[model samples]
Target chain A: MPENSVICLKNIHKSFGDLKVLKGIDLQAHEHDVISIIGSSGSGKSTFLRCINLLETPTEGEIWITGEKLKLARNKKGDLDASDPRQLAAMRARVGFVFQNFNLWPHKTLLENIIEGPTQVLGKSKDEAIAYAEQLLRRVGLEERKDFYPSQISGGQQQRVAITRTLAMDPQLILFDEPTSALDPELVGEVLGVMRDLAGEGRTMLIVTHEMQFAREVSNKVMFLHQGQVEEFGHPDQVFGNPTSERCREFISSVY
Target chain B: MFDLKGFGDQLLAGTMVTIELALASLVVGLCLAILAATARLSDNWFARNIALAYTSVIRGIPELLTVLIIYFGSATAIMAVARLFGYDEYIEISPFVAGVIALGLTFGAYASEVFRGAIIAIPKGQREAGLTIGMSPLKIFWRITLPQVWRLALPGLGNLFLVLLKDTALISVVGLHDLMRKTTEAVSYSKEPFLFYSAAAFIYLALTILTMVFIHFMEKRNSRWGDK
Candidate 1:
């Protein structure tokens, strides 16, 4: 626990009926800490990221965002739920999420999609939100395509817009769940480029990614999960170059 | 030698009534359908069962029977309620009002199923995207789910509307002077069954064509995003 910690999760556990996906995972991200979560498929990388914002509610955990603890209560089905819905919503508003699938609303144009969170949840005026959205769209090199529907754009362009949409909320932390996993091989670079810029800006980000090279290069800290547990977590060089865990070393070799 | 000199105005008036009835019922039915579909998809067991029972009972019986029951039953039911209030006067339910209720209830039941299917056709990711962005569940439905559902449900709803237009003829049995009822009166009075009946058929056909054109325009409007 550091004084500047932005998000802290302790003993996070998630289960689906009889199957446990995440078991006793702990992570504390400070401001400007870019952490990359890397593991093989079914290793709970995405689930661990989703639990931070309560997307997939953890079975048992204490999550604190910017030092504010999230309150949870057991419902009739014995599944945990937010005791105060408004608190959950307010907390979620401050934590941005980028899905693996672009998941852009097809009905709205690129600019409209980017401004949705700012106008709808943040209660910014339409003119102000639109101006901010235009700026974000310009930064992503999508200024000209602001009026295009998501279906009209390339997968890489859509993912960039999705990132811009998250960024528009001015969140304290951003969680990317394999943001480029669904893009084509050639389209991956465009999305990675945008993420690289975000990382360079010193934003706190937790990314679940299969891009080993990009993850190794951009992230200051690398977390390797194996069999629903944190097998190795440390500086990228130590974990990637000389991981103590045998399983993590094997995974690194297989992916590389 | 078709001569509809005396009954032409009566037929015209009846066509207006039919159109008015159809439009009113469409509005009522659409509102009810949205409510029922949402209830049917909700987590509350009571709401689900109530919506299910409404759709099931209304859909299982004939539309004609529904019209008859609503026309006759409502008057009796109102009288009983009035008696309970210590006011005993015979109250009559207008045929137009009864017809609207019966037709709207029937249309709502059928349209609810159409809406439910449309809602399910949307990807789960769309709603999840809204949730992560911090929109309330109601906001998600209004902004994200309802817009997509409306687009998806348009063609299906158009077909139901054509059927609803034709079903308005059933309202004539309850003594409302709709197209069918007017035609019947003209036929018996003039003994020109072929001419007057053919005229009524033409009017109904014209109305259906107009409705189809309107629905096509609506479909085009909804596809402004290019059906992607």
Candidate 2:
């Protein structure tokens, strides 16, 4: 309810054909907050991240992005859809999403992939988008690989490019869905390093991750979700070092 | 003996006509294939069923029969429509137009299946990436979906193009003066079936070889990313 809140979810609920995945969850993200969502595999972590952008439309809830509430109504398909498509698209533009598998468009080069979202969606000129893309690629130590296909690069490098691609949009919020889960154990560290840099820059990010160490070190606030509800949420030290809920304690002990 | 000097000009002209017919039908067939594939994959029940029926009926019949039906059958239907409008000046379709329509319809039916498979092969996350970036649906198709589909469909579509090229010979039966018809007329006049028909066969082979070269070049250029 504060003025600085960038994302607010009130009573978020999602179900798939009688199977309720996310149940009545409420969370608020303020400016420059790096919130880490950690949970077991089937605890609706990925689905919750997708719902933030209406990728998997929430069955019942109101999602406010930077204080603008999304308009939703039931369509003939008996699923909730946005009443105004243009508004929905505009809302989506305000947030960025990074996938687990690093879904870079294979036909285009790294530079082209990075510039696509900024030029195509943000209405930035090609020259401007290219310049920004080059800077971001350089930051990720990938300026030399700008012309390479995603398949030609290592999985870690591909994920870095995926992050740069999302960063080029300059979105208010960046939602990461298991960004390093698909990478090999050796490659996971490189991706986590890049994310640590972003968190240092005070970016508003919500990452659904299984990396317990990264969650503790990189995020200011950590949320422990269990069975589609927040079991514990507080500062990283309090939640991880001293979890209040029995389930949270059990999850942390099992993982660590 | 061969009348190379005298009828060489006619053969060349017929070859040009055949190339033009093939290109026109290709353009028409591409449009038809895109429309048909979209309909087949779409959510509309009526559109899907209509597209399914079209592809099934066209694929079931022989290409030659489809050409015949499009040529004579369309003429009959058009004449009936003209009579209803009280215009009886004997409106007839040009042979070139009829050949293009007939051959193009058959090419489209076959190409639709290739396109459908290509579209299905693309990962769902590609579209989600586009949507997250706020690209319009039409823009997404042109930018994201089209390039991948073209890459995936190239070899299959290249094969279909060859089949479409050879099918132009069937148009000669409707008297479009294509490569085969020119060869037939030249044979009748010269009485040297061996030389004239053999020359025509060589010309068809040359055409195929040249087109294959272009297709081969395109395949090489586009496959660079797949090298790894």
Candidate 3:
């Protein structure tokens, strides 16, 4: 692993029952790198991103994030678990995750969702967390709706709030699992806009998306995932424009 | 056609006793339900099987039989334990405490199912969200999970609560002077089974109506003024 690399996944393999989803995939991301992974529904894009944080633990693999190589042990249930829970927790803290459903904790208000991680996990003072939350809400253009519950907000607004909530942890790496996939066509643009702004700020992000245009425009690197492996990966211009692999071309054409 | 002037105070006191018994039993039952549900959901084989056994045993028996067994069984155990200590005297277990234990055990079994369903209703992502933010498992459960579980479980628990309240009448068989027992005494003296029984039914109905109103208000408060 490179000294400056923010995340490195070595020979990651994941299976569920008889179905092997991710087949010996490896991934690496550095600081300020915005990598977009595009693939079909079952191509394991989301699974790859989830494996980075051990959310869906890779059946067998080595995961290194934020300078720590995590240890994996087969638990009694026959599934992999982190050998050192404390180490995994610290690693998770550095990796912010945005889910597909924009799970903003339905009972809590938008402001509360933003401050939860900062106050509870980061040990920030209430006043300080609230202050930072307000700024993040403003950045996402949801400041006026901060007091509203998740159910009361529009899908677009909720997704933006989800983004800010993940950002509140001040994670060095951010993993986005189909962030806009659940949004309506009209709502997708607003969420993508917030993400585009985050990319402009040079945040290190790993996004699994179906948006071809967003992948081509906002990301510096684009990876075409096919059957749980990176079929093609390089600069966006080469992957999307030049197209060396047949499967990558087929996928690009299918989406376009 | 009922003459309430003579037995009104006694009936009112009986109603109060009934409410107190039900409330205490429900509180105990809630604690047991949380424990049983956690055990059922535990990853360990022993804990899960033990919780399953508890629910199966308690739920399989009739409520009246459970009351009798807990009452008489506890009394015997207490007396035997006392004799072992060189104190040769019968130990009396209060009907109230016995009733609480028996009724609470029955209620707890039903409650475990309610809580399990509520916990399942919550989205899996909520816990994952907490974990990704570095919140400990204990913190995640108390903060992210329990509040949602309470909201989801309230209606079901409230439904069972009504049934459990009515079941308190069964405790009168063990000699607790609840509403049913008081009404039986009043009927025996007056020779008007119809009148006293009607009064008893009215008291239960009135208590149930009041409870439903309070539960409705609580539902609204917990909903934050609107449905999700």
Candidate 4:
């Protein structure tokens, strides 16, 4: 592992009973590396991102987050599980996840949703969490809607709030699982703009997205996943401009 | 024509007792239902089986029979235990206490199924979102999951509560001076069974109507964050 590596996954494999989803994949992300993961719908891009946080619990692999390894054991059901629950939670605390559907708590207001992680899990004082939450909400241009419920907001605004909620944790790495895929075409740019700004500020981000052009413009590196493996990984220019793999070239051309 | 002057006060008192019994049992039953529903949804095999057994046994028995067993059988069960310590004094259980246990247990059995369905109705992503944010499982259930569960379970619970209120009349069979018992006493003395029973029916109808109004307000309150 590199000294500055933020997340490293080695030989990750995942299976759902008879179906093998992720076949032996490895990825090492360094500090300030904004990587865009692009592939077809069933190509395992979301599963790969979920594995980093132990959400899916890779069937066989080594996951080291900032030099600390996640220990896994086979439970009685023969499925892999984090050996130590506290360790898994502690590691998860350092990572943020934004879902494709913008899974905000519908019962809570926008401000309360953002401050929940900091106050409940991180143990920040109410006043402190509120202050930081206000700052994040303002950045997303959602300061006025802080008191509104998630259902009352537009889809694009809700996705931005979801990102802001993840950012409230002040995590070392953030994972975006098709964050804007559920948004309308006109609303996609607003969410992509927030993500692009995050990349500009040197946040470590792993985005599984279907936006080919946005991925090319915002990401320092682009990873093309083909059948649960890293078919092509390099600078956006190299991977998108001139891919070496025939499958990679074909996939890129199809998307473009 | 019925003369209400003789037993009007007694019937009103019985109505109060009936209301108290129903409220107490409802409170206890709601707590039990939440606990049982949580157990049913838990991963522990022992707890799941225990909760399943409780709901199954209570729901299978007739509510009146449960009241009778608790009222009549409790004294024997208590004395048998007391005999173990050589203190064999006969003890009597309060009819109110017995009534609460019987009705609460029955209500809980049906309501727990309602609660379980509500918990399942919530989207899986809500829990996953909480888990990925590093919240403990307990915190996720209380802070994230339970509030939503209550919203989803409100209408079902409301119906169960109304049934629970009416079921309190079953306690009258166990020698408690509830609305039905007082009305029966009045009728026997007055020989105007039709008039006294009609009064009792009116009282029950009033209570049910009041309860429905309260439930309507609750449903409205819960839907505040929902559709515009």
Best by DockQ: 4
After superposition of all CA atoms, the RMSD between model 2 and the true structure is 1.7
lDDT leaderboard ranking: 1, 4, 2, 3
Cα miss at A26, model 1 (Å)?
0.7
For each model in turn, which proportion of the native inter-chain contacts is also found? 0.66, 0.63, 0.61, 0.71
TM-score for the first chain of model 4?
A: 0.98
lDDT of model 4 at position B179: 92
Residue B41 CA error for candidate 3 (Å)?
2.4
Per-residue C-alpha lDDT of model 2 across residues B1-228, encoded as one tens digit per residue: 335848998898899999999999999998899899989999999999999999999999988888888888888899999989997867667778998998888889999999999999999998888888777778888999989888888888888888888999999988889989998898899898999888998888888998899899888888877647
How well does chain A score by TM in each candidate? 0.98, 0.97, 0.97, 0.98
Docking tier of model 2: it is: medium
Q: Which of 1 and 2 is the better model by TM-score?
A: 1
Better of 3 and 4 by TM-score: 4
List, residue by residue over A111-215, the lDDT tens digit for candidate 4. Answer: 999999999999999999999999999999999999999999999999999999999999999999999889889999999999999999999999999999999
List lDDT for all candidates, in order: 0.92, 0.89, 0.89, 0.91
What is the per-residue lDDT of model 2 for residues A1-256, given as tens digits with 9 covering 90 to 100? 8345899988889888888899988889999999999999899989988888878888888888898888899867565678888888888888988999988898999999989988887889999999999999999999999999988999999999999998998888899999999999999999999999998898999999999999999998999999899899999999989999999999999999
lDDT value, residue A142 of candidate 4: 95
lDDT of 4 at B182: 98
Fill in the DockQ of model 4: 0.76
